[model samples]
Target: MSIKGQTEQQQAEAQLAVGYYTELFKPPLEPKKLPPPAKLPPVPQPVLAQRVPGAKEESVSGAWQIVADKLKEQILLRHYSPQTLKSYSIWMWKLSRFLENKSPETVTTSDVQRFLADLAVRQQVSASAQNQAFHALLFLFRYVFKRDLGDLRDTPRARFQLASFPFRD
Candidate 1:
């Protein structure tokens, strides 16, 4: 009621908080004291969603340069860094060529696995690079190519790594 009666913060808080609570439903449950939620770094969304549909289409002159080109365009239009466009384009180009200038629909899933294996064994690329190429190719099929890559039967199995058992000694 008077300036002497309460601190200004308390008075302001009281004024702001007035009539904020209801008396009609007081206590069937105790007020829950929840710990403040942990501050979490936002989960980065999957990058594959950036692929644009209707961009990839059949090539009139040859295999679809436009599909791979448009994917580059879409990537640029979305302002993705230049590095992503470079990496994706490299894989896209290789895959389209690997299909031997055929329509995407004409290609089978086995072709992809074969390509990867050949890239590893024949081309002598590292496993990580093969995996990167595989992911890039997958994004093309799932998003740009817009169809099931169809039971990729040649999935490389987990290779056995030789290790000596400690108990054997």
Candidate 2:
């Protein structure tokens, strides 16, 4: 337009025309503040497992505590892995809970069977977990309590679902 000798007024007008059309085509601005988020119901906090009457304080109270300590000692003496120690200890605690802090000496194979059944039927634990719990209890009975927990009868086994494999060409 300058080379063709258009006036300064003419060039300004042309730019203003383009600007007007751009403004007309432009999308409207989003609201600065979204309507205050919908009022939400208060979320409930998770309830922790309530402690059994005699389960707390491993020393001076629970008889299971003494057996638990012995189990730990035996596990350590055998140079078992930390994971093994933790799992065994956890299973022992669970047994204590199941028994309502009763003496481990009184726990027969039937009790173990019931606990394992609860894991499978009630708690719905996986195959490996149920097996791990079984082995842990086995160790506790055989070594710690010095009782033979022979043949846990009527024990519910955890059902493992195997994934179907694809055939290769």
Candidate 3:
């Protein structure tokens, strides 16, 4: 091709390359709109009833239900895992039954001690289960009830058993 024709073709190619790079780096004309946060369904309140065998049917108070709801709220607000929430809820239900659904405000440290002892002695719960219960109660009192759980030094502890292997020398 002639020199002028070649020069025009080079200019066109350079413009095309510049256009491609500019489009590649250009910001989007409109920012993406994210969907609104989903609303969580309301949690159902657990019924407190005498679950022990041969225990007389009694109408316990619903005070513990309020505490459980508060515990759930605190756990959700802190962004804790769903499993942690479920564990805490189970422990709280057990505790409420042990306390005969007593109002959380009236619960004393001794009551907590007796409950822990009962788990160890009567229910024979595993060490990890007992520990989870302890932590759940601690969180309940600390956050939900806004009270300090006093010394439980004398509470009976659940024993941890080692897994034995028959082939071990």
Best candidate, lDDT? 3
Q: Write the per-residue lDDT of candidate 3 for residues 43-129, one digit (tens) a residue.
A: 445554435443232334346667778988999999987778888888887787787767678888898899999999999989998
Candidate 1, residue 12: Cα displacement in angstroms equals 48
Q: Would you give me the overall lDDT of model 2? A: 0.76
Per-residue lDDT for 1-169 in model 1, tens only?
5687898888988876764554444564767899996542321222332333443432421345566666666665667666666777777767656654457556667888878777766776666677788777776777677767767546663333345335553
Q: Which segments of candidate 3 are over 4 A away from where they belong?
A: 1-60, 163-167
TM, every model: 0.50, 0.62, 0.67
Consecutive 10-residue window with the lowest summed lDDT within model 3: 52-61
Ranked candidates, highest lDDT first: 3, 2, 1
Candidates arranged by TM-score, highest first? 3, 2, 1
What range of 10 consecutive residues in model 2 has the weakest lDDT sum? 39-48
Model 1 lowest lDDT segment of ten:
40-49
Whole-model Cα lDDT of every candidate shown, in order: 0.63, 0.76, 0.80
Position 139, candidate 1: lDDT: 68
How would you encode candidate 2's per-residue C-alpha lDDT over 39-147 as one tens digit per residue?
Answer: 3222122122874344243332346667767887888788777778777888877877776665666788888998999999999888999999999999999889898
Question: lDDT (0-100) at residue 38 of candidate 2?
Answer: 50
Q: What alpha-carbon RMSD in Å does predicted model 1 have with respect to the real structure?
A: 13.4
